[model samples]
Target: MARQVSLATQLAQSPSAWNGHIAPLILRAMTDVYITLAWIFQDREKRTDEYVKYGLGQRKLWLEHFKRSLVERGEKEPEKNLFVKALTRQLNAERFEHITEVNVGAWSERSTRKMAEEAGCLDLYRLAYTPFSTAVHSMWTHIAGYNLRRCRNPLHQFHRVPEDSDLEPDIDYVYRAAKYVAKTFALFDRETGVSVETPSSLDQFVESLAHPTGEAQTDSPDPLDDL
Candidate 1:
């Protein structure tokens, strides 16, 4: 969760990540991480081991895919593959190669939506999970709107031509990222009943941005800033 929040903060430093397209994608990823941690912490005793198992299974699946890819590329004797053997040893160091089972399936053996529902964050799944896949999968609903623009020529019948237009940087992305981090910390605090006496760096950053001066401000932020 901390790593994911750090990634979101790093993304906020990028102007390109301030736009509607890129920012939402990163926000969605953070949202996913939030959901995953929320679910895992619910049953740490059992879920942590499950998480490790699934993670190792994924690594094994990847290693298998790498070997298959090499074989498909007309590489004979991929068994003695140098990189594969090294990776196998590394993974074996964690657990024996024969011990971990590969699962060509979801991490929890359940849909993300289901997990989110159980994790009490169905809203995150609704808002962040499926909708953001458009930009990733290049769906018409997303690209047809964001990645296309009208032609200037009157002779072209105002047809939409594909163009990657530069969008104005929005501060809302930073806030959203902060909110996700806040939500994660809130969850941790609620479960553990222990939090630092001082506020988190994100809390300070947001409060400072929301109230630049030392005094507290009650006014609403700019409407567009919330977008």
Candidate 2:
């Protein structure tokens, strides 16, 4: 959680990273990470083991792809063999290539939706995660509505085409990202009864929005700002 939030904070520093085109991807990933972390804490030993194995399996799967690429195109691209061998050696530090089992399915053998349901965060999955998935997957529902605009030419049939969207920067994504980090902190405290001296990044972000003179801003803040 600390690492995730630290990376998020660094990304948040870049205003361009907050755009609708990119922010949803990070927010969606954060939601998955949070929900998965919460679920893992419920059964740390077993789930963590499963998670580690799944990651290794994925690495092996990637190594196999590289190996196949080398075999198929070794003559044309000889450097790939050296890179693949180097990667295989690095991966073998933990478990041998022969011993590491490959699992092509979900690590937990349960879908993230099911895990989110068990973790009592199905609402987050439904509202934020699933909607953001449309953008990540480039679903017709999102691209057609967001990226494509109808042509104004009356002579030709109204046809939709992609446009370079010029959308105003929305602070809402920052708030959502901060909220996820805060939730992670809260989850950590809840699970381990550990308390830190400093305030969460979310609180700091909201507090930073105040006028420098220590007076509150006059405008009505978004309700989520209270988070």
Candidate 3:
């Protein structure tokens, strides 16, 4: 008879068996959260700019000066406020020059890397896991009409839901992307002597070198989508 693998044993083997799959998944999840937050902040900034430009109209000069002064003050002591810190660190001065030019996707990619650099691998791991967890929880909540926070394996919660449903596709895509990120990072860890296990395939190692996209599109959503 074959020996049954315990959860502990399965998890113990994961660093070697599933590192490749998990790395991308982590990256994908972080990307999603970063992109969503970027959109929210960018939208807010756009509305504020519009108000200053149009609402204030002929008084635009005064409004612009006030805005510039506010930004300068925020830059001088950004650490005093969390929002200012984020804006200064994530949204560079050049990018903030024109609200319309803000690309959440691009910003998220750059910000994530900056986070990884300033913090450490573990910090990046947390950033990736937190949003992925929230996304999975949200998916289960929508399908079961109840929270699935207590579930041992949130991924299983997805299986109980419909395949063609609105949230399912997103959940699946995020999960896959997270897996890819985890694998990539794990490989990096091993290469840098921070991890014990090494990746078996170079495919993930190669993929990590390429830039991440907004999201995986099964079909071409638009011709300019890639751009």
Candidate 4:
């Protein structure tokens, strides 16, 4: 049987559809990190004995898979290695300093805004604000999910608690940290003017930045040989 075609499908099939699909997905993926962390923290508060064990197990598996994928590409390409290194450094710094330092607090906001202005990304800043806020909401949802799963209190009962309330500073911190990383990457992409379509791979991302359009591709050894 032939499937019925819809106008939406036809529009999606068009080459110039201007579909903004990737933006949402990127935001979601980054936000998921905060959501997962919120669950871990909420479970801890509830004294759910299995929460830590299960959550840590899940986190280990997820991090292993993510690191393996990043490392594989880094091994084959110099430019990719540099990007992976830089990303690792940034993530580590954020993790150490905590997300509150990067997200919602007055100092954090001032610093972030300054960086965005310096990078000439005020437009990206405006566009990403809602996505960043959405990510924070996703984190709250995760916390709510944990509370519901534990049967401690119904989600509706807790609905009155504002997201930025002083009740859950840790969760807010996690959300802020995640947003900081996203904002940084978005700024990098904007400044480099890298095309996100073809370069889905880490190697391609690094290569595109290292070798922008109209630049000569070198035949020499990998630039990251020393690393």
Which candidate has the highest lDDT of all? 2
Against the true structure, candidate 2 has what lDDT? 0.83
Per-residue alpha-carbon lDDT of candidate 2 for residues 1-227, written as tens digits (9 for 90 to 100): 96668657866886777776888888888888998998999999999988988888899998877767766864565435678768777878876567878999999888989999998889989999999899899889888877999989977698887987877778778888899888888988999999888988888888786545456566855577679
**Winner on lDDT (1 vs 4):** 1
Candidate 1 structure quality by residue, lDDT tens digits, 1-227 = 66777867787789777986787778777877888888888788788888888889888889999999999999998879999989999898997478888877887777888889988989878877778767767789888878998899999899999888888898877877887887888888988998678887677877788677756355755556557
Runs with alpha carbons beyond 4 Å of true place in candidate 4:
1-22, 34-204, 212-215, 219-227
Give the Cα error of residue 149 in candidate 2, in Å. 0.9
Candidate 2 lands at a TM-score of 0.86
Clashes of each: 0, 0, 22, 0
Order of quality (lDDT): 2, 1, 3, 4
Q: Which stretches of candidate 1 lie above 4 Å from their native place?
A: 152-155, 211-227
Q: Tens-digit lDDT track for model 4 on 107-133?
A: 212344444454454454566544554
> TM-score for each prediction?
0.84, 0.86, 0.20, 0.21
Q: How well does candidate 3 score on lDDT at residue 8?
A: 21
Question: Candidate 4 — number of clashing residue pairs?
Answer: 0
List where candidate 2 sits over 4 angstroms from the true fold.
Answer: 75-80, 212-227
| Whole-model lDDT per candidate | 0.82, 0.83, 0.41, 0.40
